[model samples]
Target chain A: MAVEQVAMSSPDERITLTDDQRRRRRSRSIAIAVILAGLVVLFYVITMVKLASTAVDPSL
Target chain B: MAYVNDLNATEPVPGVSLATPRDYFELLKPRVMQLVVFTALVGMVMAPGSIDLFSGAVALFAITIGAGASGALNMWYDADIDRKMARTRLRPVPSGRVAPGEALAFGIVLSVGSVALLGLAANWLAAGLLAFTIFFYAVIYTMWLKRSTPENIVIGGAAGALPPVVGWAVLTGAVGWESLVLFAIIFLWTPPHFWALALLKEEDYRRANVPMLPNVAGAAVTAHRILYYSLILAPVGVVPSFIGLASPVYGVIAAGLGAVLIWKALPILRSAGTDRAAARGMFGYSLVYLFVLFAALLVEGIVARLGWF
Candidate 1:
């Protein structure tokens, strides 16, 4: 019974869950991470575009 | 106008919150400060004036601090509406991380400190503009216009657009058409940029009872307004190049981007679903537009200094 209880707990206390629960949590985290990463990339692109638009001639 | 939050006396404290120092800092709205600092720096750079490294640094610091002060005061005043909005719910006063009184005090201190620093490091003209900018944003924009009308952001944009003017003043100790043109660029840019955001977050504004364009006007009207403004913005963007502050290179780019902006806006006016994509694209492009325009001016200034022009 003790071994069974131990088996029920995942190794990662950060997300203590059954195997199925662990799998779902992991997927959700990946999705959120991806979204955040995408937002960061988008922000970078916008910044670069802003920098590029302003080239001017010396006379002007 | 609600300089103090009604809920400041009533809301329960949050279990999860930042420290007092963090909350105070948050009240300044760092992102807005960043915009203010950048525009002001660009204005300083593009102006026909000279400053040693130390004085220039001091001037920039003063302007940034002044911008931050305005943010603090805006936060101090808007704590009530902020508490009501999910987006602003986590702000210091709303979340009970910092007391309204503390935020108010912080703003007042920074406001005075920034003005004094600018006056000492730069000149009275720059200092005066900084003071006016703070008042214009905190009092005029936040305290008065924010809750009064749907056109609040439109009119309030002037305060946001003044940093460059303030920078120009710092360099020349006077105003000129060039700085005014820079001001005009931003003044025109603000409506379309914010209207798009307002269109996207109409529900949030409605819940908060703020009179953002989308909440006050129907979607169709808001879309029309966006298109109308973009149409104006498109042509006006080319003026800097014509005025000799920028080159024809900037002119061509501005014209190209302006056309795209107008194109993006057309579908938004015709239908609501397209509003989001259009708004997002416009808002994103608007940043690029201003950045490019300023970069052009900066390049012109640098080249002229190097005797290349």
Candidate 2:
């Protein structure tokens, strides 16, 4: 029955995704967002460290 | 938006449409960018002065972006010729995945942003070299020499060779002989490497009217020239060891790889324009030779820092 329904769909309408595929895509998107956020925080911390190091006097 | 009305507004959106994230990334020519980044990193690691991890990362990132900007601009300008070439027909601009205007804008923005950020993160000298590299590739090579001369790759190779120099400058704030040697190796390697590929793709370049060496000078002359360049490239590849920048191991490996490169070129020369496989082999081996040579240098640098060498 599922094969018959799939065969009946037009080529243009064949892009429909299964529930599992949609869930996987949503998980991928969230993973990417988390990674991006982590990178941003890392950059911020590095910049702060750089600034703090530059502020210290090396002669002492 | 209403000012430009068309009855036949289509799905592809008739020029001035949104591009996918992947399409924008494709405009960067990631493979070329990888080489640029790796060479630049090697330069940074080999330089005398030390850079903190954050600053080094920033400098490398800026160089990567600058290289990508140059690639995008080249794609934008060469869209017509690219459409004619089988290998480049599917590029973002030529394939109509990204509009030329959009590409130009993207490139310009990244070029300025990268240069400015590099200047802020590193020194102006490194940033200046980065700017010049982008301009040399986009304007001097792509706009001028590529269509006009058979010696295009020879002169244009300078832009590609500057990344290591720029990398060294990022830490030292000035160019040095060590970086110059790296630059020389790449500068000399470019002709032989590219000409080998051009041997195989001569017809495509001829069809596009690009005046590549094989297309203009005939394949036999091009093959001979590749051998000529390879001879010079071999010695230059080993210079880093003599100068104390790399270990003797690197020198030996570079010499062996260089000999193999010359050996690969020999078949192309003897084939008398008939050996497509020989040319392809030379092209493939050239890439591996460069990667291995540089990787050897990187390992030498690491070992030296660890005081194991």
Candidate 3:
């Protein structure tokens, strides 16, 4: 039997993420990305410096 | 259906006139996704070597998608029980905002899409871990354990705890002791963390026929269990520091926070309260403790890499 669509109001009201919550989450994500990017670049530069200093010394 | 008719005809009405695709998206519990992503990211960071921006973004994206897929699948499986519980009754499927079939389809699609993409962007190992995580949560935890035993959360916590391992695999293409420690930290953290809330909402669990620890074992037993696990968890949480992945500062903070976690569990172990203030306090502090410990690890990791330590 095809049950008729019940007309009862929903017991479960959906809770959407609020604009403020979205903004906070977004900003936090961007901050983490920035920190990660900064770390990568810093690593690259340091590795390059150590390589260059070793090349100049050519001993030990 | 009669249920839908009754819902449409009820008092106070629903806050939204109709649930769109986005509303169904919210039902996937995106907040939980954020925590998973953060822990996974920390695990990736602490792994040996480094990743370029483009590859890192791709890895994080794959992880996020996998997490979202898991959430959708969880909602799909639990839709029936969710409708009966006051806490989960308002979820999209239970509330009639989204059909159950739609959620099932959404989850399936994300699951396939994320795993395939992860395999391409990261490594097969990481992708395999993602696949396993999804199956573990949706099948093992949801379909099997959730209805079977009071030990459900204890055993099922593994699914939730694998993100860091997934994160580590993304870079190294293998699981090592370092990532294992991260996994252990979260694995041990989950039971005490969730049981506190379960204690607070014992009645809700009972109403839904879900055999949470407090409902099955009594509040005193549940509280004592929480204390025992928290004591073990505190020392386990600090193991990474001794292994050279973290600094002394992480050790000190972890010990302090671990002490505080035990302190929070102590009151509840002694007495059950009508208001749930102790459970609430534990729940809140647990969030802060995990966040602080992970953040400390990240800071120390960066400093050590920079030779500032």
Candidate 4:
């Protein structure tokens, strides 16, 4: 039996992810989360450093 | 086909992308990024100034990402030729591990983010240079020069040599003569270095129709040209000592290294070009030559910064 394009499944039927696709998606998601967290830390550290430099020196 | 169709469709599909994080990382060309980061670090250290720890760290990070972004864009654009070249056949984009759109998007995002971060941490000049380097690599070299001329690497090399200048500008907020000295070494080093590998990869480049020196100019001309470049590179290699960037001892060491590099190239010229063993030896030594030269400069920078000298 020829399966129609799975992408057009009825709205009520949720699409099922293949195991390989799910695994890859999960790994990518974790990587993105780590990178985003790293960015947050980076911004935090930059702010502190800038604040400290200004506090230590008020000279023009 | 269905998956590809789903991806490009106007309505969002529920299918998950098969690209893994590692594939994305591979798209960055980590090895090239490492060299960019190292040279930029040397440039920063050699620049006469000071940076806070945080800002310095951020500058390096931004430069690294910028270099990787350019590498990704190179891969994205060259995916067609990469598929043909044995050396580049397994690259993420060519291997189908990452989609072309994904790689392009990844490169664009990193390029913008890196340049913005650099502007905040360093100065506008550094950021501008980084942005220019990306554009030069992705557009000027990859899109234009790479296909049309055998002298592609000779000119495209400028893009690679700009990292140290960007690094110097990060700390100094302007280009300096000392930074240009670093840039000159890389600019001169590039032709001989790439031509040596070009001799080895002649077939691969021919298959890809990339117009590498050997593919267009023949092996004899390529080998002779390599010799001429090496001859010029030898003296330039030791200019740091003459210019006060390094101790006289470092100069002597650099000269000795240069002599050995010239010695390695002799067999290629003696054989009337394309001596396989000579090319292999030169390729290996060329890597060591650049690394040691930069390492010596890095040591000088460290010693001067610490007042050990």
Candidate 5:
């Protein structure tokens, strides 16, 4: 079931999202959220690897 | 605002976005990205020395996203021409599923993000190469050459060829001689492969006013050029064996594939631009030739890595 949404397109004007638009927007939002989470994990792991590499190599 | 009917609304509405996650993904030209990732991986595998598994994976990720960013930018810039071509008419920007501004923003974000991530995850050389590749494809090729010149695919092929070099740089932290051989193979392969498609899509390109080789120089010239490149490519494809990057087995296979490519090209040349079937056959085998040739190198790389040599 697609849920319709009420969004403010302007300060004085209200724009309504049709159910399908709302559904697609929700999916897009979810995808973005997931990708952001993946990036966070990637950054964290890469940082740890870099730090560990530096720790093992002291001759800089 | 969504002014369209609420029931079963599949079409995009003005000022309202109906684009799904899939439509956004389509903007990246995933098939092209697949080829990019594959070739870059082959480069990564064949380079001297070894990269840690995690770092290599991350580098590949960066390259993949960078390629996608370029694809998105190309879609945004080429939307008008894309709309005019039947093969590309249904692309996201041309179909109105994704807005041009959205694609541009998506591309820019991914481009920056990928470069930064690559710099952090690997070395700066690979990151720089990825950034340059994106710029060449998006601005140099898509925004400039494609609209202006018939040799667009030829010069633009350089951007596509750089992936392996970038891949090599990722692992070795410097571009290797072996990688240039990889680069040359793809660089030379691009014209024949594209011109063959141009033969079939001559009308589409001409209707769009794009000066593809076939549309500008005529099909006979294009076929002759294809023969010339095919002859050069067959020998170039076997260069990796002498360089010790590929095994003799792979070199033989590359030779066989190159021979098949030439055999396919021979028919096109003999047909004198009148044969669509010959062009199609050439196009189809070209794909197989590159795939198997690369797959063989990948296999040899894996065997060497695993001490199976």
Candidate 6:
């Protein structure tokens, strides 16, 4: 009822979102989160690889 | 289409606006960011030392994000002044499509994240330069100098000019004379490029109370300044060739481009102070001059690497 009331009030105060708009927003948020997580993983992997490459060989 | 309206809404939306992804992207000033990325890439390529593919890619990505962060923060802080300028009135923040607070937060997060990642991926020297660049643009230039001084663009130009140096540092883990030359070219070119626009938009700048050169000094003074900078920039454009950083062919191209830029500025100098057409032509040619100068370097570097020369 509040949403309906706000919708009916005025053009400026009301920001009506269709179901599709909401869905797109949710998807964009998820994509950003996933990308951030991927970057963290990448940094970790690269650091480990660099350290391992510089480590002394035990067999030698 | 389905529509819903609130009849009583009269105030500005308080972070409740439906901003799409594109609005957020626009806040990054993608056009400016593209030039930043291109110039940075040329610097990296022209550097003497070689960088591994993975490291180079990561460094470039970090620099790109850092450039975007500065753009976002600039928009956040300049929203009020931007609203008064015809050229910037339609930007995301001034256009009411994005919340200013959101832009600030986005900028800060990206700024920190990009610098840290760049340090980890490449070296701290490059990261330090990038961090200082963001600070210079956001705080020194945007917050302080822009409103306070007519020479704001001259000082703020340092922020834009440092990308090449940052890129060179990423590759060599140090700064060199070559990178400094690249930085100088852009630094000197900035005044003529921006002041030409200022000449045309003098009224808009006056309305916003921003102390652009044309607003503080008269148009004749601004035109003379543009000519002075352009004359200096023309010779500096060919410095890379003299230093052996670029081939002689690049020297010829740079000289010709610089000549064209001088020719463009001549009209602005000869015309009456109110000549928008001359100012616009100079502004447009300045863009071409910088792009082609860098493009020549990029092409020459590729040719040398391929042994095609």
TM-score of chain B in each prediction: 0.91, 0.95, 0.92, 0.94, 0.96, 0.95
Q: After superposition, which runs of candidate 4 have C-alpha atoms over 4 Å from their true positions?
A: A1-15, B1-16
- Across B25-136, the per-residue lDDT of candidate 6 in tens digits comes to 8888899899999999999989888766777888998999999999999999999999998999988888876778888998999999999989988889999999999999
* Highest lDDT against the true fold, candidate: 5
Of candidate 5 chain B, the 10-residue stretch with the lowest lDDT total is B1-10
Worst 10-residue lDDT window for candidate 1 chain B reads: B1-10
Better TM-score candidate (5, 6): 5
Q: Candidate 6, residues A1-60: lDDT per residue as tens digits? A: 111224334455555544544654686688689888988887987687556545744442
lDDT of 6 at A22: 66
Candidate 6 recovers what fraction of true contacts? 0.04
TM-score of each: 0.77, 0.85, 0.79, 0.92, 0.94, 0.89
Off by over 4 Å in 5: A1-11, B1-14
- What candidate 2 gets wrong by more than 4 Å, as runs, is A1-47, A58-60, B1-12, B15-18
Ranking by lDDT: 5, 4, 6, 2, 3, 1
**lDDT, candidate 1, at B201:** 79
TM-score of chain A of each: 0.59, 0.71, 0.71, 0.75, 0.73, 0.66
Best-to-worst DockQ order = 5, 4, 6, 3, 2, 1
Pick by lDDT: 1 or 3, better one: 3
- DockQ (C-alpha based) per candidate is 0.02, 0.05, 0.11, 0.35, 0.38, 0.18
TM-score of chain B of 1: 0.91
Residue pairs clashing, model 2: none
Tens-digit lDDT track of model 5 for B64-156:
999999999999999998999999999998888898899999999999999998888889999999999999999999988998999999999
> Candidate 1 lDDT, tens digit per residue, B1-309?
112222231243232122334456687899888888888988888888786566677788889989999998888889899988888988877776566777788799889978987886678999999999999999999999999998998999999899999899888999878899889889988998898888777788888899998888777888888888888988988898888877898899889888888887887887862458777777787788778777776777778777886
Q: In candidate 4, what are the lDDT values of residues B1-309, reduced to their tens digit?
A: 122223332222334355788888888889888889989999999998899878998999999999999999999999999999999998887776677888999999999999999998888999999999999999999999999999999999999999999999999999999899899988988988999999999999999999999889898898888888889988998998898878898898889989998888789889867589899888889989998999999998899999986
Clashing pairs in 1: A54-B292, A54-B296
**Residue B242 displacement in candidate 5 (angstroms):** 0.6
